[model samples]
Target: MELTVLGTGSAMPVPERVQAGYLLDDGDRSLLVDCGSGVLGRLSGTGTGYEGVSTVLLTHHHLDHVADLMPLLKARWLAGEEHLEVIGPSGTKSLVDGLLDVYEYLDGRVDLAVREVSPARSFSAGGFEVAARETRHSMPCHAYRFSPPGSDRDPTDGPLTLSGDSEAFAGLAAFADGSDVLVHDCAFPDGTDVSNHPTPTALGEVLAGVDVETLLLSHLYPHTGGREREMEESVRTAGFDGEVRVAEDGLRVDI
Candidate 1:
């Protein structure tokens, strides 16, 4: 599988980083995780257009995370792509309704389906087996674990995880345990305590003993500037012996 970082900024847009969005591609079968602001354009910049996205999963309803939801749906409609099935938290149905209601003109012009997910449960969507666990964020948030359809064994050689915008949680420690690659929230650099989000220090501590092949930091806050080296070292100090790289928009990583 190949992991692509479409946008890695958290709550704010920064140079080369837009918002929290990513794409996990296992050959042609792809899953889009969190369609935040700037994602539609970023997808094009990455040379991976939105037409190939068959499924989308949102971690929460935060604006930085779901800002471009409707735009993406509309884009697919205009591009002649088939309708997409969206899976999200409990309020997802209502949120989708509200969004469409605002753009009521587009209603019925496009076809869409929705599924409200149960926390800490596993479900299937578009040939992917997904597991979700709640996370500590100001708003309702979830961390998603995805594996290929009908196979626990990863087609890309191992498992892949997307730790949504979240604070350090025991749930996530358990969420990504034994996975091949962990795409975690490093919104802040080490030593920055802003609550409901994970700084590298706390994340490193929690992941110190966990079993993971690599750790890639995403959801970067603007304050993370000038501390990139420190953050990388922090994860290393906590016993994560695999790959650690600060996310950059449009970067593609093979897992």
Candidate 2:
């Protein structure tokens, strides 16, 4: 699986980084994760017009992570595209229905499907086998694990776990343990005194004992400036031997 970080900034979008969003592709098909306000523009910047997104999976109903849902759908609809699939946490169907109600134009322009997901359940979106897990956070957020078909116990094609905005908690290890890559929210720098969202030091402890291949930190705040190296070193001190790195907009990774 490969991932494209569309936007890595948090609730307040920075000039260079928009809100939270990403594009996941496995050569044959592509899926979107989080559609922040500027996602479509970012997709255009990637040089691939929004023509064939296999599906969209939202972490929660938070506006920063979902602001671009209608925009993406409208753009695709106007271009004569149809059959869009969207999956999300328990309130996903109602969220979409509310949006559709507000934007009446969305009613007949596209054939959209919605699936409200729960933790520990498995589903297939496009060609990916997906699993969901609830996380400790302010909103009804979740962490998702994505796996492609025809894979072994080996991590060469192991799951990619995306930990939506969450506080550092024990529940995360099971979702991240022995995974290929962990894209977690390291919203604050170490010793930054935070809760309900993770600081690098706090979140690192949860991942310390996990058997993941790489740690790609995202959902960064502007205050996290210039502490990338320090954060990686802290996670290492927590016992994570795998590679660790900060996620920047437009960065891509494959495993």
Candidate 3:
């Protein structure tokens, strides 16, 4: 399995980073975890064109997280790939309809299917056994854990988790308790008390007991610039003895 960071910025745009997005590829299978602003272009930068992505797993309906949703669907259509499977939170279907409504010309140009997922449930999609759990965010958000289909390996062994925007909470930690790679939201550095987002101090406490092979801190803000080492050390101070790395756009990891 390979993981690629398409974009690493939060809602606040930074020249150095784009919005939140990622791509998970396992040989012939590919799953796009999010389609935020500038993601389509970053997808191309990863050398995996838009046509190769047929499944998109959206965490929430935030603009920064879905600004390019319609553009991606249309790009695929232009590339002769008309079918897409979009799974997201409750209002996903409605959001798709609303997005397509704006671009009336592309309404029926592509075969887009949307699934609104429920928290604390497991489902199958695109060769993945996915588990979804609700997170403590201002809006409805779901953190996802993805494993290869039909393999009963322990969750700690290989399942990769994407922790959507949330404050450090036990529910989210439990969802990602034993993951191979946890791409968590590290919106800012420590001493920042913004709600519904995790700083290193807060996330360190959350990950203290979780057994993750690699902690990939993502969903960064401009404030996180030049503070990567501090973030890693904070988590380490909390007793998480795992490899911690900050996520950057176009970062590709093969596992």
Best by TM-score: 3
Candidate 3 weakest ten by summed lDDT: 149-158
**Backbone clash count for every predicted candidate, in the order shown:** 1, 0, 0
Model 1: per-residue lDDT, tens digit, 132-239? 888888888888777775576642233878878788877688878888888899888766658888888788888877888788898888898878888999888876
Q: Candidate 3 on 170-239: residue-level lDDT in tens?
A: 8788778778789999898988869999888778887886888899889998898999899889878876
What lDDT score goes with residue 8 in model 1? 86
After TM-score superposition, the amount by which residue 198's alpha carbon in candidate 3 deviates from its true location, in angstroms, is 1.0
Better of 1 and 3 by lDDT: 3
lDDT of 2 by residue, 74-157 (tens): 888888898788889988999988999999978878889898878756777667777788887888898888886544433222
RMSD from true fold, candidate 1: 2.3
Q: In candidate 3, which residue pairs clash?
A: none
Candidate 1 regions exceeding 4 Å error are 150-158
Q: Candidate 2: where are CA atoms >4 Å away?
A: 149-157
RMSD per model, one decimal: 2.3, 2.1, 1.6
| Candidate No. with top lDDT | 3
Candidate 3 residue-wise lDDT at 79: 90
lDDT of all predictions: 0.81, 0.81, 0.85
TM-score of predicted model 3? 0.95
